[model samples]
Target: MTMTSAMPDGRAERASTKSFYLIAWRWHFYAGLYVAPFLLVLALTGLMMLWTSVLSGRDGEKYYTVTPAQTQVAVSAQADAALAAIPNGKVVQYIAPRTEEGAAIFRVNNGDASSMVAVDPYNGTVLGSWDRRNGLYDLANKIHGTLMIGDLGDRLIEVAAGFGIVLIVTGLYLWWPREGKGFGSVLVPQFAARGRQLWKSLHVTVGFYISLILMIFLVSGLSWAGIWGDKFTQAWSTFPAAKWDNVPLSDATHASMNHGGVKEVPWTLEQTSMPMSGSDAGKMGIAEGQPVNLDGIVAFARSIGFNNRFQLGFPADDSGVWTLSRDTMSNDSANPLSDRTVHIDQYTGKVLADVGFSDYGVPGKAMAVGIAFHEGDMGVWNIVLVTVFCLSIIFMSVSGMVMWWKRRPAGASRLMAPAVPGDMKLWKTGAIIMLAVSLLFPLTGAVLLTVIALDYLIVRRVKPLKRALS
Candidate 1:
């Protein structure tokens, strides 16, 4: 009797395990089908932007590098030169040179278009000019973020990224060894296997190796998405405007300063209310009677620890404040910990609000660091590491498609998706998982539910549709 009981229990356990594997595989297959194309575009565009940034500097700013000189011209002179280059233009922001030999950059707005003017800091000579949004880096970034189609593209990318998280979870579950296979079989691709088996091995191993990094990429990338990141996560993670200490606020937020599709401010401050100028509510900043001009603001920026590379934003109007900022995402500094933004009263030159990395909330801090890593801004090592990781992503995507193709029967009219086990009885667990995913990622959860509903209500009842789907 004892021997018979043990035999039945072992068989039951094996059956349950197989059922779960089939469930995981089915979900993984569907998620991969939807996410692979998006992943390919994201990885390729990411690589293009990365190399462009590393080689030519952010937004092609390296095109204006200059030789160092003993004496330097005034900040006002540089702004004047930039404004002169673009007639009828107004200087919106000034970017200090990163190195002694680097040229200063000025953002000038003429009508609806924006231009970047590179100037020699030594003699205030106008080096050259380029459209801010027309550069290769900006163009690639446009596609990378929104696919260059605006809000609709943003929503699609957001959904893809949301589903990508699901893909990672299911892929990991599928990769977990259950056959008592040795570690080598899981980590190393089986060279002896041929055709579909070899491709499967490569896909599994590559997926396993890049899983962690891919997760980081997905979460960080999602934090920039429109619905989830901007509306949900970022809304709560941003630095509180209440911390500005009773300063009057403008209608605009710090994000308003981010012009021409370029991110000029740190993520944590993007949604925070911009403090209006002309108030006596700020602490003493520029010395009494100092002219609140470009030169004065630049000096004040240096006095408060902003050095080498930082942005000095002009007041938008009578109510706007001068913004001094530096962050890794903007290529202002390599250290995310050094991220800082200060708003100064335009008339009084008083510091209105000073926000640093330490002031950011938990989510804000994580995103700040995550974005630095995501953008490969830490150093040369970061760039190399990210490049390899991107290549791995591309390989995994291609390998997955190749495996699907090989597994597909010749002249098959159906998609050949993984079949769900008929004996599976894990609805309760699946429901809970879906609930958790819905709460965490609304867009992805909705897509999963829609697919489930369609499969049950339409595909299951229609013979042709069921055959095509399964």
Candidate 2:
């Protein structure tokens, strides 16, 4: 009697395991079907940007390489040269070169148009100029960030990223070893397997190997998404204006400087208010009787330890403060630890507010580090690792599609998604988990709800549609 009861119990356990596996597989299918295309695009564009950055440096850096000289030209003279190069334009910002042998870059604005002029710091000669944000790297950045369709594209990518998290979670569950499967099968691919089994093994092995890094990519990428990143996460993680020592705030935030799909400031300070310049309420900075001009600001920046590769933003208006910013996100510095931003009073030349990585809150700090990793700015090893990771993603995406195609029956009209199980008592738990994900990522949640509604109200009742979609 005991042996007979044991046999029934074992059978019941196997059935339950099979039921849950089927459910997990269905969710994995749903996520992969939606996320694969976006993953491909992201991987390709990311590779393009990374290789370009590593191979050629920033867009116009090649033309700006110069020989180091004993005596450097004045900052004002460099600005004059930049403006002279781009006739009838106002110098909006000055970028100190990464090395003594590199030329200073001046961002000159002519009405609606803007350009970057590379001027030699040694003799203040105009080396070359190019339209700002017109490089291939910048174009690839727009496509990667927002698909180049603006706000709508941003929202869609956010949804895809949300689903990407779902894909990773479900993929892990599906890959988890069952009762008879050994640990070796989980980690290493079984080349001995043939047909669909071989493809499945490759897909599972690669997916499992890259799961953690892929999740990091998704979360960091989502931090820049419009709804989840801008509206929610960024709003919460923004550096506090209260830390600015009661300085008068401007209507514009630090994000205003981030135009044309480029990040010019640190992520932690992007949403924080910019300090106004007119107020005389700050520490002594540029010294008395020294005019707060480009030359004075440059010297002050140097005095404050802002040496190579820092940006000096000109005052936008009478109330605008001169901004000194350096961060890995903007490729200003190689070290993420040294990320800093300082606002100086345009009239008084006093340092109004200064923020660094240490000043950021917990979330702000995490994002700062994460952004550096995401952009491959840490070092040469970082670039190599990220490149390999990107290639892995592309491989996983293609392999997943091939696996699905191989599994589907020939001439099948339906999508052939994993079959829904009968007597599935665990569905309610799955629903709750999905609901939580929906709450966390509202855009993805909306898409899930819409699909459920369509499936229940339309697809389930219509016979032809049911066959086509199931």
Candidate 3:
């Protein structure tokens, strides 16, 4: 008969582990108590980002810009035509889609407000259009972008983001390896620890794996919210807009855009100096002979053969030009403009800003790449990453709430629980972790310091409220 060997007991291992965990548990509880309200807000905001695509089908790229048929027309020409088409209209703003199939919109206001026309740049035909912000898509954009909070909503989002950053900093300290723990204790779950022991590992272990990604996504979300978002994009691009000496601000034919009654002409820098009859560049804008043909301009754009998905803006000035903006995600190097942009002088038939992916330096490249990533526009791979991030947040939130509930004794979870230190080593280890965590999340960190101080002052000196909070 074979003598079966009795496996060694993990008694010493279990004792040390219990000591470490109980210490980790209470301050962790304290940190959570201070941060949970903020975390709940994040959960809701994150959910909005996750579901934006479904917010409304308005972003579905079905919009268009209309003009005289050729291949392209100056967006200015189309705007002028549109203004003529509807009297007493004002140009609100415009957007050129980054795809050949993409539509350009000229937001115009009448007695109330509405889209005066949706133009199909491909054929210069007026496609479907509507007036007013009553569309389901518009509503979705507002809700997703602003949370119906408008400007105040933005500040709140930013504050929550700051809190998130703090949480990440603290969570990292909590995860720092202590003593001689191996990979299993750090990276994977330990099945044997009971009550909150099992859960502390679960919360921490899961966060350990996903923390880097969580920070990226949250920070990126902040960047998407305000004026900084736009500035960030421009800085990260390869092509900086050409700066000109600030002469007396050139008198823009801007009046034509705001009001429809004026005769429309090609917009250019020279035209801004004086009336066309009075100046040379102004003369170049409108012919004594006739306004330049739209078909000719459109054909010029198609001739250059940029990729199909670009938004084309017509000249807003007297240039009779078309501006093509393409969204290009860079493959290597820094230029944000890499693989982005196309401009055609419809008159001189010259390409102005023919930027490729190499144009943006470090920042531009990073920015374009990030926006594409956040929108799930980079490709299938990014979508997978985004999906995983979303699911992780949901899991963390749910499991966290459950774990908090489970660890409490019956009737002890009235949002107040007494700390009974039956174990000193455990409490000591927990304090050390809390001290480390405070280094990152200063707010939560400050609270932890207060508690230890209390344990010194009141809790040790007296001990009633300390029992309540801990």
Candidate 4:
């Protein structure tokens, strides 16, 4: 079986395949260079946050108590006690305890400062207070979300997350074994392999295993991003206010309920307009003999089945309604399916609107569950699974850098990127795919276009860069 007679197009097919692999390798390398550091940071911070949340809890023991009295003081008395603790402070919200032995948490504001005041439910005594955003768990969350650099950090992280997808895709293609290679080559690393081969084996094997989970994490995390998550996805998928019949809408939104620089409402409800309190348009009214106050609102909330660690956002202004929300997003309830939000007219004592998981659209429902899983709030199994996923991400990022370092020429001054293939036709298809991805992820698209332009205009034109890169 001579080669010329065996297959007329054998050489062309092999060349095409080789070119595809090289293109994939080049993009994979570029994406890894940018995404690896961000992934490492995300993995480390996420791991710390997960353990902190699981072990010590977000509020910590200072927010709870060990004993429960037979008789508890009124909610109003608790609010007064919390007010006395901080001079010139106003009560913003009241969080019900998870159990009888737990203390109620109150959000108190004093001028520019916000603090969480834990009050003993039994006798209305202020147990302790701490700045809401300065807690260790909150610090980890801020770093994880914004790198503590605010909006700029948010955009940069979003770009990294977007390109991370590109890395995963190209990595998989390059990792795919050629014909005659067994499953062990794909599934298991050869410990005997040395240098770059060892790194490649470990990198590909671990990357392949965590690819799906990593993708899920990226998508769910992206849904919280400013542009994609908030403007595009969340705006379209949020719970609509049209469901509320004849309720007067306020200029303020559910975002106003997010006091102390922390999000208290569910993602889908953040943009939903909060209904005003002036109108008596609600269907449900307060119980007989109950006054239109915190006690009545609490009773109303319990009557509607909002139990166990539900949060209550007090009226901020005349138009504001008392908001009672319970969701797995806040770790208030264990089950995502039980997520609910109720708004009550502060004066008229009417239930303005109530939204539950069933009321959510497909996207909203999915996000609810996804966020719970993302935060490792489901159970012990979820914590273990998320921990493994985080560790795998860390390992993959470190291994990728090792591979790149090993592949670079000795004493190289520039990035040793993969060479461009000779045939340009295959790259046209790749360019179109990259364009589509960029369009979907705005920041990623802009970065990719800039890199491509630099490669053509700057990198290839500069003598030192071209030589080093080659």
Candidate 5:
């Protein structure tokens, strides 16, 4: 039960331990002070993101075909019913419908152009037109996203994420044991061990193992809120322009395409080919503005190879075109248009741009794959990886906060580590390690350093705190 000194030279050990804390604890104190609020917000928001995902989970609505009355009613008729349901002055942003099921959704402007409402296509029933931010779930989302304070909240989150990355990295460095120790000691918690070392062991050992996953979450999340993420997304998405074979659209159907803006026609009909964005004629030429036979168009798509297709995203502008992207579920590719995209004319129904998975560019393919990885779309195998990453984020958020909280002092704490007698080598050594570890968390260190510089002028040089910590 007696402690034995392993150090052969006591003096040497004493020397190393002496100023350790003065350097370390002080560093830990200020770093935490600077970014605690930010860290806290990130944790809170992250927790919400986690819990909310489950609450919001719903199977994509299962579709059932309406009776003959419903099927006989065209989109135009449903559009009329919806018109009467909505308060006048509002405009439709988009009308989405399933021909087979006869269910339609109109994303509408709720008088005020800035906000929108979701309307039922079947009966023109108004689900609700509410501000997304003001709703309970949305409020949580905004708070999690921007802290509800707007730009300041956004910047704080970014800064916090930046610091979080730093914390994970430095926590790893601080966690490194002095060489010779092997896996079991490092990995398994020594339950009987008391104080800081026990907790640090739990935090670092577990935290480091999960860091890569945490980093992915952090980076992916940042993409949702920043320009860098958009750039990353764009870089990864397929820009079909370059790889596509650009043919002239001169002979392409001179039929009125969309409501107003021009759109490219699907280049090829078969599974092997994709529509290339053609020349100015294909881009601009369109003659008749006659209303195309809606039923015929639908039948044509079915005949060409787009069976069991997901909802089509009809293009809006001149550069826009109708595309039939497939549903990932059911592995349905029977329709030639089934596993791919078919961009056709609005009036003549001529193919403008037809692209399938085969022609997707590297970036496009990478994006598809990366997103699948990010979202756990691959398989049960990938779900394991995705689950690990999500759980890691939950842990990192928790541990980082706990470490910060555990280190903080009892009251209206200042941004400085409390000092103990440097004369005791053990205390000094512990303090220094704390300081170094805290410092390693770049944000904490920077904040502490700034506080140290300021503390001299205020607490010591100016007045009050001299009585407190001293």
Candidate 6:
């Protein structure tokens, strides 16, 4: 009698486990179907960006080779060379060469168009000039950010990233070792396995290995998304302008410092209001005889410890401050912890406000470090690790589709999604979990709810739709 009762209990437990597994598998399938393409694109573009940064540099071959001189020409002279390259051009920003051998990059505006002119610091010769946003690497970055479709594409990518979390979670649950399974089977792909089994092994193994990396990439990337990053997180993470004591705040925010809609300010100060120039409300940064120009600002920046690839933003108006910034966001500094931004009065050459990494709020600090790692700016190891992670993502995406294709019945026209388990208890629990996920990722949640409503209200009620989905 005891044995018989134990048998039924064991059966019941196994049945429950099987039901939960099936539900998780179904959701995984659904998520992969939609998210795989986006993941592949992101991985490819990300790989391109990584290599471009490593080889030609993010600004392209401009940073590659320049003969260093014992003494270099003045930054103002370099600016003149850059401006002379374009008719009626106004210099907006000057990016000091990362090294003595690197070319100085000047952002020039001519009417409605913007261009970046590279000049040799040694001779103030125009090395090259191109549209600021048209570089191959920049194109890759744009595709990675917005898919070249603006807001709608950004939203779609955001949703995909959010759902990618779901994929990782469900994938882990599905790949969890069953009783008696060995480490080799779980960790390594079995070459002996054929067809779907081979694909499944490869997929599960690679997915498990790269899960954490994928999560990090997803979260970091999402931090730049429109709704979640900009509206919510960025708003709270921004440095408070109240920190500037006795300085007159400008009507413009630090976002005005950005060039061609590209973020140039430190992540923490992007939303913070900039201090205006006009009042004698800052410490004198320039010498008595020096004028407030590119050369003076560069000298002031170096004196204030803004060294190694710091960017200088020329004053936009008479009241605007000359902005000097060094942050990992622009790859200006390798160390994210050393991020600093200073605004100098263009008229008085007085330092208006100076903010550093230590001054950032908790969220700001996290993003500062996170963005550095995300961009593989930590070191060569970071580049290698991220490159492997990107390749793995591509492999996993392709393998998943292969597995699905292999499993499909011959001549079947419908998607062979896993059947919904008959147990309402598990289904209800899943619904609750999904609800929580939706709340956390609003755009993802909206998409999930729409799919659920369609599945129940439309697909279930319509025979053709039901058949097609099943």
lDDT of candidates 1 onward, in order: 0.86, 0.87, 0.50, 0.84, 0.46, 0.85
Please name the candidate that would achieve the greatest lDDT relative to the true structure. 2
Clash pairs of candidate 6? none
Off by over 4 Å in 2: 1-7
lDDT of 1: 0.86
**Candidate 3 residue lDDT tens string, 1-470:** 21112323565455556555545544455545544554555555544543543332233334433333446666667666666556788664445445455565566667666564666655455565565455554454355455577776655454445445556655666677766876678688877888777877887788888888777765565454453332332324323334222212234422233222111111111122211111222112222343334444334444555434434445545543444444522111122343444444445444444444455556545655665565455555665677776667766766667777876678772454424444354566555654664444333345456656867878656556655555
What is the Å distance of residue 356 in model 1 from its true position? 0.4
- How far residue 73's Cα lies from its native spot in candidate 6, in Å, is 1.5
Candidate 4 Cα outliers beyond 4 Å, as residue runs: 1-7, 61-63
Ranking by lDDT: 2, 1, 6, 4, 3, 5
Q: lDDT value for candidate 6?
A: 0.85
lDDT of 5 by residue, 287-384 (tens): 35534343344445566665542435444444444454442221122222223555555545456655565666554444344433444444556556
| Candidate 1 weakest lDDT stretch, 10 residues | 1-10
**Which of 4 and 5 is the better model by lDDT?**
4
Error in Å for residue 373 of model 6: 1.6
Worst 10 residues of 2 by lDDT: 1-10
Residue 440, candidate 3: C-alpha displacement in angstroms: 11
Global fold similarity of model 1 (TM-score): 0.96
How many residue pairs collide in each prediction?
Answer: 0, 0, 45, 0, 27, 0
- Candidate 3: residue 350 Cα off by (Å): 6.6
- List TM-scores for all candidates, in order: 0.96, 0.96, 0.58, 0.94, 0.56, 0.95
Considering lDDT, which of the candidate structures 2 and 4 is the better prediction for this target? 2
Q: For all the candidates, what are their Cα RMSDs to the real structure?
A: 2.3, 2.3, 10.4, 2.7, 9.9, 2.5
